[model samples]
Target chain A: MQTYSLKCYKCNVTQNDNSISRIFCEKGCNELLICEDISPMKQDPLQSMRDDEESFSLGEGSTPLIPLNKIGKRLGLEKLFAKLEFMSPTGSFKDRGSSLVINIARKERVAEFVEDSSGNAGASLSAYAGATDIKAHIFVPDSAGKGKLDQISIFGAKLHKIEGPRENSTIAAKDFSKKNNIPYLSHNLSPYFSEGMKSFAYEIYSEFGEVDHIIFPTGNGSLLLGTWRGFIDISENSNLSLPKLHAAQSSIIEPIVAEFSQKKWNFDPSSKTIASGISVSNPPRLIEIVDAIKNSNGSATSSSDNEALIWHEILAKEEGIYSEKTCAFSFATLEKLVKSGIIKKNEKIIIPITGSGLKETT
Target chain B: MQTYSLKCYKCNVTQNDNSISRIFCEKGCNELLICEDISPMKQDPLQSMRDDEESFSLGEGSTPLIPLNKIGKRLGLEKLFAKLEFMSPTGSFKDRGSSLVINIARKERVAEFVEDSSGNAGASLSAYAGATDIKAHIFVPDSAGKGKLDQISIFGAKLHKIEGPRENSTIAAKDFSKKNNIPYLSHNLSPYFSEGMKSFAYEIYSEFGEVDHIIFPTGNGSLLLGTWRGFIDISENSNLSLPKLHAAQSSIIEPIVAEFSQKKWNFDPSSKTIASGISVSNPPRLIEIVDAIKNSNGSATSSSDNEALIWHEILAKEEGIYSEKTCAFSFATLEKLVKSGIIKKNEKIIIPITGSGLKETT
Candidate 1:
């Protein structure tokens, strides 16, 4: 097994110890700890290995990359592909992260954990915990959609609905973990969890080769950061062109967008957005997410609930992709990027439809 | 393009005339028409062709075959696999058939169509119709799940909810088609739709090779007959042991099961079961389904509502597969088949979890 180290993305401070029980920089820099594989490799370790490996899978990964012809034609683009991440076992891309995080949890023999999510991540953790026989207590905002909550409980997890804002749920979950002396496997802050998302980049590279652009729905920037690292790993051994990564978020609560776009923005916690998955106003890894976009020469854009809902309808009516409103941000922002001539008409672009409409509330 | 013919499954009667505009035989035989490709192919045309074959796809096919380890161990089985069919676009296995049927529809230039479904097939057809220029009028049972109905309408299909019994929807759909002089693309009776499912067998052969057994939740028997025919086609040119194909249905109304078990049974429309997808008392292809089962030396079994719900919970809790209760019938009956020594303890088995639980009623 190759040794892994945690490095602060902002300060470039590296910790040689692999087993540091640290969420970020030890100096309290409030930065994201990026997991870096110490050893260099030419290919993805997960792809070459057989299924008989100790890694657990709830049928996650290898989601479809389909061309959005009808919508693409309307946008005056030749190639627009959607990676249907919603088809994951838990009906969201969080399954990719949860699969790896829970595998490590199982290896460590952590019997109980507490975590908070808007909805998808909670459901994802509940599923992996149920499959691995780990007791989990998930905290979600009381306003979270019923489908995601029902999904969490269906997998035998204890669901705690916090009545206040989404941040309150996080605080409650962290307090519970601290009081109970159990691990808090926060999908947002867990370095191990984001490592699982690197598979997305590897799959995109292997299947579609080097696409010109990739857009992602950014929340805590799990998918965004993991994908960047994945491409960086691949570039270490191969002469591959890394696609320019972009982030799309709900206009109402656009922390990452505000940071990268250098716009004066104030986040309103009371305000609500239909794309609850990306409704994170004060993302923990805000700096790291902005840094990832800056490093990749990517742009951050935001869309309104109405625009997203309209695009959501377009995707269903035109492309037959029944995805959550959160995913519509990619398409709506794609239009903006195309209009500004930031993305050319003929470039092959890929977007991750991070969640399914089956769990969406009208 | 190879010519295709529809032949009666009962009498082995071949018809060279391709366009009789008939769902079944014109002889009033109450039998399903089997699609036979005339250009004698050694392999599936779908397997050998490239993507630009004019066939429409919503990322259907190639569902994961995950091992149900925890449940398998408890059941004293070594190899227990589940084909997660619910992950298909529109959240059901119907997408497979809809892909091919609508491809043929586009080629046929039939603009307007009427179809009846419990839920999954209607949503699938509606999605395909929305993708193309075809106008789809979907007639569904009023008692159908809300998620499926919403899904149909989301794709811009006209939805007609019929009251009183599942048969009323079919009647209404057929009547509308006749009155409007538009084609009726009945997924339950469409021969082309089942041809789409042939890819399932091809995928199984290519991925896992020849397994000992494959089980399906039987309603109109589209999947079962298509799989059997696909294996038959493959067996003609290749040396492979055909898996024993099994059928499962709700205990309340199981025409195929009764026919195979040699038991006289009556179906009550009012008797409710959670497996609404398979609540068909009078499947149009009853004889064909039974014939497929018997020819493969397979048996049929039925499970009570309580048993099915119990197994459904077990699959969700143990295997991390959140599928509809309709799929639970297969697992419930599998235990009985194993106990009866029909299915051995150590044989490799695959069951198609036919629908996602996201559409299940609260």
Candidate 2:
């Protein structure tokens, strides 16, 4: 069996694998836990995962990389492609993270858990937990979309409707987890979930060698970070250079965008946007996300609600890909990148469509 | 190049492959056209598909066959599997058919079309039609769920909302198609559409060898007919026997079930169920659906709305598969088949989960 240590994202604090289960830095530094493999042996993580009896799989990974030939030509690009992550079991990319998190939980023989999400992650976690017979308490804000909340409850997760803000759900979930001694399987912090997203990057590399750029809809930066880490791992084993990784966010609540743009962002309670998935005002992995963007020489951009919605409709009408409102940020940003002479007219680009359009309403 | 003919489902009449596109039998017999290979050659369809530069793709087929281990044990079974067809790009099994139908349209150089669906097929066809830059007019009943209608429109299909009955939408679509000289790509009757579903059966056989039983959610019987014909084509080359193909339906609208049970079904416009996908009072493929059921020595069963809802919840809560109320028919029928000694407890069963639960609000 492989062994790993929980390393704090903000600091140098690390804990051994056998230590008590935790979601954040044990040194009281408010940050996400990054799983660092401590086993001093030469082994392939991907091979090990493949060899394991697929733990309650809904065919999570190895999604198709569809070339947007029509959209590409329209946008003055030769190789525009879409990584169809929205076609997962839970109708979102969170399925990848949920699969790995659930596997970790199953390995630990954990029977109960508490987690918080706006929607996608909670539904994904609930599905995996139900498939494995693990009782889960999913905390969601009262303002979360009705479709997402219904999906969470449908998976039989105990729906904890936390009042007010999304942060309240996280706070309530942590308290419940502490009281019940259940592992807080946070998709954002748990390195396993982010590690699961590594599969996405590897899939792109295998299908298309060295795509110039990958545009992601960054909410809590799980996909963005996972993809960057996956590329790093792949690059270590091969001569392939890491693709420029860009993060797109809503202009209304642009934490990652603000940081990347070198501007200060204050959390405004009244701030809102149609792109509900990426409206996270205070992402815990801000440092890692910003570092990845800077290291890869990638730029971060934010789109207005009108711009996002317009792209969302265009993606459906012109491209035949009906992604969620949040997904529009990728296209909107791509347009800006092309116009600003950042992304070349002929360079290849990949965009991860975050979730299903069915999950959203007119 | 491979060649085929559009053969009538009920009679021996066949039309040339290069002839004008048609949906029904040429003799006005009110039967669907079934594509039949006429070329004296040995060519694998899969290979041909790969070489064809797939016209438009959202990565429709090859969904996961998840084993319901825990739920199987609970039900006193050793092998129970689910073909998670809801993982498709449009969040339904109809994508498989849509991909094929749209591909055919692309090859024929069709510019625009009209189609009518209950919901899932409309959304799927709209996506494909949009992806290929083919303008489409979608017709749906006014009573169709708001979420499904929203999804259909989001895909950039010009939706023609018909008032009163579902049949009116079909009539309106046909009238418009004829007036505009555009093809009416009926998901229910088109030969290309049903032929596309053949992939589902082929995938099942390749994965499981020869399963004991395959249960389908029968409305227009597209999936049921496709799977049966696929086995027929495969069995011609090998010695694989066709598995028992069962039909499951809602009690509210049991046209196919009634025919299979050798009973007359009365039209019930007022009598309704929540399973909107299979609420077809009169399926055009009624004769074909019955023929397949009787030929396979399979039984037909219907579940009450309460029974469908109970199993739907159980499937989500227990099996970690959150399908629509329509999908519950398979589980409800399975229970009956088990108790009646038709389906042995030791044998394997495969159920196709049709649509997403997110489409339906609690």
**Candidate No. with top DockQ:** 2
DockQ of 2: 0.72
**Which candidate number would show the highest lDDT if scored against the true structure?**
1
| Candidate 1 per-residue lDDT over residues A131-152, each given as its tens digit | 9899989999898777888898
Q: Which CAPRI level is candidate 2?
A: medium
Model 2 per-residue lDDT tens digits across residues B68-114: 88767867888899998898888899988888778778888888888
Relative to the unseen true structure, what is the C-alpha lDDT of residue B154 in candidate 1, on a scale of 0 to 100? Answer: 93
* Model 1, runs deviating above 4 Å: A1-3, A16-22, A26-30, A40-42, A45-52, B1-3, B19-21, B26-30, B42-50
Maximum-TM-score candidate? 1
**Where does candidate 2 chain A have its weakest 10-residue lDDT segment?**
A41-50
Q: Spell out the clash pairs found in candidate 1.
A: none
